[model samples]
Target: MSKDEMADFLRRRRDALSPDQVPATVTHPPGRRARRTPGLRREEVAAAAGVSVSYYERLEQARAPRPSPQVLAALGTALRLTAAEREHLARLAGQVPLGTNAVREPVSADAHRLLDRLGPIPAYLVDERQDIVAWNGAAVVLIIDFGLLPAKERNAVRLALRLRDTLCSAPAGAQGEFIRQSAAQLRAAGARYPADRVLGELVNEFAAHSPDFAASWRDHDVRPLPMLRKHLRHPELGELELERQTLLLPGTDLQLVMYTPDPGSPSAAALARAETHSR
Candidate 1:
């Protein structure tokens, strides 16, 4: 086991978190002294993980024995580690049967073909970090022309958080909800792929530039990008109500996200017209 690496990982994860972000169920010590530094103190983490402060300190200092699976699990929960982060921690402690840590699986030829066959449906592909990897012609018509943007700005969360007025035409309430969900998904991704440099940079960028996004991230909510009813604006078509269907490709982090309007509805007709114009 790489004790030094594990210790560093543990310390970084602990330092990244703030006390208010900790789960409410964790009980802080009675009359605990104020912390001079940021993040949960060693004693607070130990209390949350049901361990002694000295033991956690030893783990942080790379001087402790190999942690058991149970203790690791406790530490994961205490530190609010996501599934991917927990698996990474276990692997660092010499645990076998660990899952792969791959991120941003390449979009397959088959996936590309499927998007082409979708016709007027606004469809695109997103990696775990919600970066738009590919899209169909219909997506260009209905959503923004992703091809026009630089690759770094092609991320859904980054665009939504930084350019809501320009990217989203949904009603104010729905737009807010969409931003909230996007932030939550980003938080989960940040936990799952803590070593992803680009993802970390995106988070840091928004944290500096976007107060609402930073606030939402601090909530520590994690959820899959679920099926959502969204209102999108088209320059020629005005507004269209589209229901989003997300398909997580098996054995990969790629998500096939498509927006479809209800059959026989005005939005559907509008989408057909938009599709024709694109053709």
Candidate 2:
């Protein structure tokens, strides 16, 4: 909650917005000076936000004292901030400390029983950070060869991004799309638990390694898991189409993801054959 850090963040946010995003019209007059600033001028933003230009400047400079909630809201609106950005701004302004431990600890016995009950479906539990906290036997068969992957890289998102490159000859586009979706999930989780180091590192690594991931992360698209049809070529099973569903484990920051084959499809038949082989 450092004021300097807040000021820096605000300035970066302001600089990131294009002039067109603001209300002002851009025009060039003959023999007149062209605008030299990168983003909307501070005065224009102050005017739109209904604050004194000097005060706004000082706030951006970290010289003004803490901003009031009303002022924060006005600024947020003027800047067209997203919900996540608005929350970050609120935390920075000392309006409230961001909550922590959103992922419930020591997942209850009942939850474990529920996961066990989901037998025969490729079901697994993931913490808010996307770590594989637990999984049913069927899950191991449908997804990665979990026994082969190292312990540290067992995270679903990480495996989808990094291991896919090595383990599967997936098309670049499919792999890229998978990384994009995983990054979006990570970002949504991040908005809720900003201080989670593991989440932050996963985001950084994916953004660094994948252009699609970096772009999607910047777009700030947050979506809970919708049914996703994945095209996968399993070494043992050949090819299969699977639908993935993510279910929230109530009272915990955990998700239960299960993969099922579409009914009446060859992929469904293949899954049945694979299940038999697994047993």
Candidate 3:
């Protein structure tokens, strides 16, 4: 990583930590001190990470230092680094080198066929940047006018949020939360592809357009969206509830997301009807 890039990462990581997180009890009045700055003080964080305050300050200042694995571990703990963030810090420090920035090769022909075969299940393929590279028929029915989204804005998370604002006239609430969670996973993938221009642009766009996106992005939140109930309103299907599943493609920064309706629910019955019509 370039020095500027490394510096940016360090600053982000530091700003994410809190005084209480580092075992520092706030002696001063609450609101005044708490609102002073976003993250823990350098000395407090350094003490928590078992490093000298000067050394930690130097690290944050982009001064090159060969940090021992032990020190890295302590810093990781002190900063509450997620697995991806910890790995990113290592990469930035030269302890590890994230390889080339390449858009992963397109899904295999067989994988494409398999995705097609999963019709009526609402499956779609997304690259690390969350671009909707492909999708099945059922996906079309479940998501509202996804094809209508501009190519630049076709990202699953982006679509979910923008569509909510445009059509529903209210924030997507739980759906928005779910998309933000997915964006965090995408951000983690970004650490591995720091030089990817497309990925970089997507991150920048979210940071610019969406406050929720910006907030979650800062938190360094990195976790795949676990199974969750999603409420979606489809013109044809009316209102539907579905369970979402996300599967990561091996050896690539691709993800396959599929939605299945709840058993014996109105949504399931509507899905069956839509599938028949689609055929």
Candidate 4:
């Protein structure tokens, strides 16, 4: 592994994180501590990773030739690296390749039709970049209005960032969790496709659009969908409790994300209202 590449990667990851993501900090959770530099201080990262400040500094400075497996693991945990990211780190550190494949999947026509048939079910398909390749009418109603957005902005990640202020309509905890998950999943994709310039561009775009995104991206919290429960509140629809599921199309990278309401639940009742409001 080239020391230069390693240094660049380490510095980029370090700069992306905020003080909250680092455990050794003077501030409280979800609260910002004013600092001259963005991301966790080097000493904070060193403390959290269980390494000496000098050692971590050398790694970032390319003075330390190579890090041991144990040190790598410690850094991964401290940085909240996703599986993909950890694997990428290992590869960069002269370890085995994890063989990630997530790009180049094409959406099928059958999948589009299937989404149409699932009436009142909020569903959409996202590629590796989390772009909204296909979304049903119900998805537009309950989840987001894909139709109203610029095609390029038809992305779940972008929606979460661009509409961050309004997204707090859901319980604060749930909203925070979803944002964290979206950031994690996107980072996972970045690890798998490290050379994808578009991913880097999107990351930059996110940084510009949302203040909270860059920090969450560093936390590396990966949660692939099919989440057990998701509760969201709309300006007009009131409250919604939806269970989300992901069905991956075999032999492809595209994923079908569909929401289902519990039988006799309030969300089930909200379906009719969602339909009316959407129309």
How many residue pairs clash in each candidate at the backbone level?
0, 0, 0, 0
Q: Residues 82-192, candidate 2, lDDT per residue (tens digit)?
A: 776776677767787665546458767887787767655677778877788777667777776676767677798777766574446345466666666677677667756
TM-score-better candidate, 2 vs 4: 2
Candidate whose TM-score is highest: 3
Q: How well is each residue in 1-279 modelled by candidate 3, as lDDT tens digits?
A: 445555666677777665565553422334534457778677666777778889988877777567777888898888788777787777666677675575557668877887888867888888877888878788887775467767787787778667774334223576657757766876777777777777777778777877888878776666556576777766667777887788887877778888888778787888888888988
The models' CA-based lDDT, in order, is 0.77, 0.72, 0.73, 0.72
Q: Is candidate 2 or candidate 3 better by TM-score?
A: 3
TM-score of each: 0.66, 0.67, 0.78, 0.65
Please give, for residues 1-279, the per-residue lDDT of candidate 1 as tens digits: 668768877887888788888765453555756578988777778888999899999999999999999999999999989876686677678764432344445788999999999999999998877889999999888768899999988987776665566656567666666666667667655555556777767777876766666766665445455778888765678878988888877887788889999999999999888898888
How well does candidate 4 match the true structure in TM-score terms?
0.65
Clashing pairs in 2: none
Give the Cα error of residue 46 in candidate 3, in Å. 1.7
Q: On residues 1-279, what C-alpha lDDT tens digit does candidate 4 reach at each position?
A: 546656666777777777776544432335655578777666677888889999999888888867889989998888777676677677667665433445564567898899988888888998877788998888887767787878898887788666656644355566566666667666666665667777778888876765566767654444464574677766666777877777767776677888899988888888866766766
Error of 1 at 57 (Å): 13
Better of 1 and 4 by TM-score: 1
Error of 2 at 115 (Å): 3.2
Alpha-carbon lDDT of model 4: 0.72
